[model samples]
Target: MSGIYIHIPFCKQACHYCDFHFSTSMKKKEEMVLAIAKEIQMRKSEFKNEIVETIYFGGGTPSVLTSAEINFLIAEVYKYYSVSDNPEITLEANPDDLSSERIIELSKSKINRLSIGIQSFFEDDLQLMNRAHNSAEARKCLEVATQYFDNISLDLIYGIPDSSQNGEQAQQMSNEKWKQNIETALSFGIPHISSYALTVEPKTALNKLIQTGKIAAPKDDVAQEHFAILIEMLEANDFIHYELSNFGKENYFSKNNSAYWLGKKYIGIGPSAHSYDGVSRSWNVSNNALYLKSIQEGKIPNEIEILSVMDRYNEYVMTGLRTIWGVSLDKIESEFGSGYLEYLNNQSRKFLDDDLLFIENGILKPTKKGKFLTDGIASDLFILN
Candidate 1:
C-alpha cells in the first residue's frame, strides 16, 4: 500500500535546532492550504492504481492548521484518491497546540493519530532547544490528548548538551533525570514514541551556538549511553524497538513510516517533501513561495532522479537495517544480482564477525549493540558506485 505525506511548512515559531523548510510567517497560510489541496488534485493520477492507506500530515507543525483546514485537506484526498476504508491519518503536532479543547477537536476529525513533539519534560531543555512548548504544557497536552486519542505518539529529544560549567560542557540530563522523563512520558499511557538524538544540523542556530561556545556540542559517548538506557527501559516496559529511534507497543507501529521502510511508494506534498516510486525518487522545491506559484500554475514544483540499481540497493540497505524487518539477503541476490549479493556478504563479514550484524532466516539485522549504530553500520555495508 502507498501513502501521501503532506508537509505543513509553517510553524508558530522557529526551533533553533530545526533546519526543515518552514516560514515563521502565517501570512501565507491560507494560500498554502489552497495550493496543497490543488497539488493533491494535480497528483492523483500518480497514485491512480495504488490504494492510499496512509495520509501523513508532517512538519513544520501540522497542528498549526485548524481542524476545519485539516478536514478540508483530508476531504481533498478522499475526493481524488482511492483511499482505504481505514486509512491511518496522522497529524504531527506540538504540545502547545494541543490544548484540551484542541485535543477534543482533533479527536473528532479524520486524524486518527497524533505525533506530539515533546522534546523534553524540563524547562531548561525546552529553553535550550527553543521548543514552542514548555515542560508543563508538554505534560498537560499528553494528559489531555491521551483521554481523547488512543493511538498517540510523542517525540523526545535525547543527548542534549548542557550549559558550559566551569569552562567544561555538562550533560543537560543526568541518567536519573532522563529516566524521569521517560517515566513521565510513560505515565501519559501513549502507545508509541519517536525518539531521536539532538543532531546539530549545519546552518542551524544549534551549529552556530556550538561554534560560538554558547552551547556545548552533544557528546557521542553521552548519546550512546542514553540510547542504551532508552532501549533497555522501553523494552523492559514492553515497547518494541521496531526502528532504530522508534519504540512502539504491540499493534501500534507507525504505518506511514513502516510503509516507507518497506519500500512502498508514496507521494510527498508541499515544499521540501520527498516522494519515492520503485525506480525513482523526487522532492519538491524547498521554497514555499515557489511551490505555491508553481502549484497555482498547474505545475508541480519538483525534481526527480531515476534510481540506479546501486542507488536502490543502497537505499534499501540503509532503511532496512534501521527496522526490525531487516534486509532480505535472498531478495538482494534475486533483484540486484549475485555480484551485489556477494559484495554485501563480503562487506558485512567484519560486522557479522563483530556481532554488530547477524543473519537469521535469510534476513540480516543489527544486534542490540549495533542497533544504536545502525546508520553507520548500514553505510559500511553499502556498495559505493
Candidate 2:
C-alpha cells in the first residue's frame, strides 16, 4: 500500500519559529492549486502497482483553503490514482480556520482526520510564536472540532521560555502552567497529539530574536524535562508513545506517518513536497512561482537521488529507532545481508551494555533512558560507507 501527500504551501501568516516553505501572500493560491492537481495527474503512473491507503493534506496550513477547493483536489486524486476503499484523508488545519460553520462543513466532507495547529493554550506563548490563533480561538476550535471529528491530532509546542525554563521558583510555576496545557488537552479528550520542542532553526524570526536578545533560546535540558513530563502524563491517560514525539490512544496513531516510517512508497504533490519510491527520493522545487510555471510547462521541477544500500539501511535504522516498532535483526540480515547485520551487532553492543538499548524478540529498541536521545543513538548505529 502507498500514500499520497499534497502540500499546500500557503499560510495566512508566518509563525516566528517556522522555517517550512510557505508564502504569506495568497496571490498565487488559485494557480498553485490547479498546478497541484496537474502534478497529481502527472504522477499517477508512479504508483500504478500500489493502492493508496492515505491522503494527507499537509502544509503551511491546509485550512486556509475553502471546502470546495479542498474537495476539488480530492477529486483530482480519485480521478487518477487507485485509492483504498476507506482511505484516511487528513487535513492539517489551524484553530482560526476551524470555526463552528467550517467544522460542520469539514465534517460533511471527505476529510476523516484533522491535525490542528494548537501550538499553545496560553496567550503569551501564542504571541511568542506569532501564531495566527489566540488562546481563546485555540480552545474554542478544539471544542467545536471534537464534536465533529473523533480522529483528531493537535500540535503543541513545548520548551517555550514561559512554560519550560528558568530558576527553581520559575521552574515550578512553569511546570504548573505546562501541566495545565496538557490537562486542558486531556479534558478535550483528543485521541492523538504531536508535540515538539521549540527549536530555533536558522533564518527564522525566532533565531533572529534570540540573537537580538528579544527572546531567549530554548534550553535542551528544559525541553528534555518537559518531554519527560509529557510522556508520563499521556501514558497515565492511556495514550501510547507510539513515536518519539507522538502519542495516540489505541488505534488512533497516524497511519500516514506510520506508512512513511515503514518505507512504504508515497508521492508528494505541490511545491516543496517530497516523494519516496523505495529506491529513490525526490523533492519539488521550494519556490511556488517556479513550481507553478514548471507544471504549466508540463515538467516536474524536482531533484531525485537514487538510494544506495547503505542509505536504505541507515534510513531504516533512523526511522525504526524512533518508534515503538524497534529495528528488526532478521530483516537486516535478510535485506541488507550478514555484513550489515554483523556491523549492527558490533556497534549496538555499547548501548546495550549501558542499558540504553535492549534486544527482545530479536528486535533492538531504546530503553526509557535512551528514548529522548534516539536520534543520537540511531546515528551511532548508522552503517557509514
Model 1 residue 105 lDDT score: 93
Quote the positional error of residue 170 for candidate 2 in Å.
9.6
Ten contiguous residues minimizing lDDT sum, candidate 2: 164-173
Whole-model lDDT, model 2: 0.92
Estimated TM-score for each candidate: 0.98, 0.97
- Counted clashes in each candidate structure: 0, 0
- Cα lDDT tens digits, model 2, 198-306, are 8899999988877876667788887888888999999999999999899999999999999999999999999999999999999999999899999999999999999
lDDT of 1 by residue, 1-385 (tens): 9999999999998898999999999999999999999999999999999999999999899899999999999999999999999999999999899889999998998999999999899888888888888989998898898888999999998888875363366555677877888999898888898899899899899899889877888888878888999999899889999999999999999999999999999999999999998999999999998998999899999999999999999999999999999999999999999999999999999999999999999999999899888999999988886
